[model samples]
Target: MATQGRSTLDRRRFLGLSAAGAAALGLGMAGSAAAQTPSGASRMPPSIAALGPVLGKAVPIADDEYRARLAKAQRLLAEQGMDAVFIGAGTTLRYFVDLNWWGSERTAGVLLTRSGDPIYITPEFERSRAMEQVRFGSEIRTWQENQSPFDLIARTLRDRGIATGTLGIEEQLPFFMADGIGKAAPQLHLVSATPVTAGCRAVKSEAEIALLQIANDATLACYHAVWQALQPGMTQQDVQALVAQAYGRMGVRGFVDINVGKYTAQPHGSIEPQKIVEGTVVILDDGCQVHGYTSDITRTFVLGKASDKMKRVFSIVQQAQIAAREAARTGGMMGDIDAAARKVIADGGYGPGYKYFTHRLGHGIGMDMHEWYYAVGDSRQPILSNMTLSDEPGIYIPGEFGVRLEECMVTTPAGGRWFTPQSPSIELPFG
Candidate 1:
């Protein structure tokens, strides 16, 4: 059975040692202790305590950076002969302002034009919070609950001299919004502007990478804490609650949609009501989101004693993960990187059906948990340096068990670097 507080004690000791060791190495204590620890910890990680101060000292994106980004967008619009880029949706809003907002209401949106500063059309209730954080170079237009935000958006476009030309729309725009915009402004042309946004977010600056590193470190702490707390009789939901509680205590927000899965059920099935039985293969696919950045991790564990089949499956998946990691070079073919692991499983006689894995090998992770860049089923895009992605491949035997292993990796010239160091062992119910 997994021991509660075992890894938490280790984490506390590790942070203490890290601080002392850093001083011994002629380097000052760096990063937040809390941010450094993962989601499920009894004690705050050293990084969380230290990160705020360190990050404060660290260089932030200058005002010029945002201006430059806006300028680039403008250049793209000019090249396409468009007057404005109609950006809507969560990801696009965050990309432009780096501000976080709730998706509860329809009042949150922005209409960016080449001629004026970005126009923010937010709900009456959230306008206060939006104005406090969101930076709009020009005028901000607010829409009340009674008024349609899109209607105001169209009216603003007309008043600001933006009509009769191409309007760039985010790929994730709601169908309703698309229709409304078309009806409101019939002469306007809207095209998918995903490529433009992707180009801006694909390349991570040093500051962005540091934030990600901090988030990853914190998530690892949470993962270790949850594993330490796991018990044989606990249900998957219990473990999930425990993990979330651990994260909450440490002042870290868990992923918006966490995947706390059990390998005991049929493939892709929901967690059953029964407690996690001994010999069950359990996997916790969760992450901690910090400062709008996310860390995705998955660990497969056995409840009590590991069976021979469990060991074999874990070994195969672990080795396949290694192969996939090795193939992801800075300039290598993405298809090759994906094939490395799939080939391993296919050669192991599991075939590509149940053992083949259901989802793609991995996807880019940053602002969004699942971004556009992919490793599998995408043959053309090559791996680029500084791109962070998850490597998840698994085999699921229906009505028996589900086994999946996932870890985040950042692309580099040599290959990929694990955001968080791989756990020492995959054996569950660590004894």
Candidate 2:
């Protein structure tokens, strides 16, 4: 998939991927036959050990793409009648400028005007560091200690001939920063930048879809490999170790939460110790990233064999997932998609609304796992082509077990399409 790739060191710094963390997850080098106890390497089955890196075709987003994104945002700002948008030091910042800055007490961000170049803001001490990753713009205004960065922002705006109109603030900006800006520039009206930011981000470009595809494919492969290596008596932690090892073998950092038996009834699972046994359900949830795009998949199955009830629930959930996908047509209301899926689950004896299906059908997936817009009952947001989202429908029955089948999908004129094929059955999840 076409994604923006970073060096392993950079990815580690950004994602906080550590050898110790990996080792804790039971990750080890591939093709090593020597069994070492006390480490997860000893438990690493031959199926997982034989896997190799699949990131050879992964590509990084080019500087031109970042510039294009800025251009689109600028157009949106003009159309929305906003003079400029203040983007904070997080995913929105990274999305537009390719800068992976960590937010702190200090103020740092970008002020993009509708008519001119993007202006970056940062601490004077971190000017050089900011420059290294500021891929879209050249003008960076810095602030010194004991000085108000908010004042600097006001000054920058006035200098750009934007002294008195509405200013859109990135939705994720800290409250203190927003309040500070309001006090410093009482002449400016602040509003949410969702119209501009989400307008640009909600839909995926071909390159981004490719990246998401690779990410989802990698996660599915990891699940398949780990499923083959499962054994009785393995704890949830042991399975997590195997998942980590599988991703490590594929040369990507990933994560998963495991639930065994009745614990699978919990949507997010529990930290309470769980062990696999015959005829019990097990749930593996979460996924990995390729470049910056992410994949979120959940697979529920059994180590030995599923009971008749388990099979029935699985079939209903799977059908609901498919119904949601088929209803996700471009120009259709987002709520309609959720309704279609909920109807399937309800008819199958699950819910009237969020009773057995406890949460929304799915959420938008992109650079962040959960982004703007969602597939839920109350949303009236219009589905658009190239928009990527999750088609996850789950039925949770407390004190027993639960079934959830999730697959990230993309919207098209023909409806929704999955990045990877859906789980064929509980016993053949990867298929």
Candidate 3:
């Protein structure tokens, strides 16, 4: 049986730990806006306790739209010469079925063939719950605890006239489960279905883009609230709790990494106690979900005032982010954006590329925070219309500090436009 908190599990899957990750995150907070506990290094974030939720619109993808996604995936499967793709209880299944299921020890998901409708697989006990959420497909198949679902899967494939053919398994599907399926059905060859799932998901549809934009906007608002509420004595946990509360107040759920002072240099950051004092640099990277679509953005700035060097590095990061955004053009190569962004960081004297400017320029962001066809150095993938990506570029000077400015942008008929405005300057990051 799927737990009632299935939605929270989905969010946790998207957001790895940071407070936002494990400890700092408080773990159980959903829209509840739980208070901080055990006061390790700090008290809770400043009050937004008086505020109410700011949620606006929320409607899941329509039935016909999910069908369209299936159509696209089918086309990709044919191109890849695969007979069917087995998606097991994750985002890919959610994307196609509009159902949120927790992957468990039992085999549960859908076996989507190259043509016709999809077959949803689940334990006999979960059939009712899974059935209620099914949007695109009607065929439901179930197996008992003693039976191997893998055998059922083989039977289904063979029933669909796929006795001996290729099966594209979801890349994230547990290898043990895939192995079980392969062992049960030796005649079927299994391959990575990334070309099917990521191929369909990498590019956002109009509805997906709208939800993504809303999610990003809400995340920005929460970050803005955190910045305004920040005080010098505040601990990193304090700010983290504040962001969580603010997200609840705004009727959105998100995860944020509040890196203070030198802690910002480590990128994803440390769990050590951090207090925001005068001239302390902070990096806030976070995102929230709108109807299951995701939004991610990062902004870096100084607390009271920035030193000249801090400002310089911040500017360079801001410039690198902008260069990456502007470099995105339809029909162009994906690698170009990363190169353009890296050039700005290198030219700004933070170069010796990949040394100080660690990590890729950006990544595809939509459903998954870091999706496929990333904007790493020299990727040969061509830019496509309505494809969404993050233009995040940073300079991390190990012992000093790090500055990363990120904005989620979508490829359009023209070029690319950010879901939210890029931080203009260190002095006025929100501007």
RMSD of each: 9.4, 4.4, 4.8
Candidate 1 local Cα displacement, residue 24, angstroms: 45
Quote the positional error of residue 204 for candidate 1 in Å.
Answer: 2.3
lDDT of 1 by residue, 1-431 (tens): 01111111122222122222332332222223332222234443332332221223324455666666776777767776667776664665676765566654384677777765787777777777777877656466887778887778788898888767778876666777877787888889878776566666666666667777776776666666666655666543444454544555455565311222343333234433455566667666646656666667777786567778767877787777888888888888777667888877777766764344655677777756667577775477877888877887777766567667778888888877887765445574223
lDDT of 2 at 43: 52
Off by over 4 Å in 3: 1-54
As for lDDT, the candidate ahead, 1 or 3, is 3
Model 2 regions lying over 4 Å from their true place: 1-22, 25-43
- What are the TM-scores, per candidate, against the unseen true structure? 0.77, 0.93, 0.89
lDDT (0 to 1) per candidate: 0.62, 0.82, 0.78
- Give the per-residue lDDT digits (tens) of candidate 3, residues 1-431: 00111232133233233333334355335235454422432333444554456445766788888889999999999999999999998777888877789887888988888899999888999989988888776898999998999999999888999999899999878889999999999988889998889889888888998888888888888777677777788776666667766676677667776677777888777767777887878888868778877777888877678899999998888888878888887888889999998998889998877988888877787777767667878799999988998888888988888888889899865667999998887767787
The whole-model C-alpha lDDT of candidate 1 against the native structure comes to 0.62
Decide which is better by lDDT, 1 or 2: 2
Sort by TM-score, best first: 2, 3, 1
**lDDT string, candidate 2, 1-431, tens digits:** 11122111123222223322545444444223443222344556767777888789888787888888999999999899999999988888888988899988899999999876789999999999988877666899999997999999999999999889999999989899999999999999999999999999998888889889999998898888888888888876566667766877788877676778887887876657788887899888777878888888889998667889999999999899999999999989899899999999999999888889988888888888788678888789999999998899999999999998899899998889999898988877876
Clashes of 2: 4
* Model 3 global lDDT (CA atoms, 0 to 1): 0.78
Enumerate residue pairs that collide in model 3.
Answer: 17-21, 17-22, 18-21, 19-24, 19-25
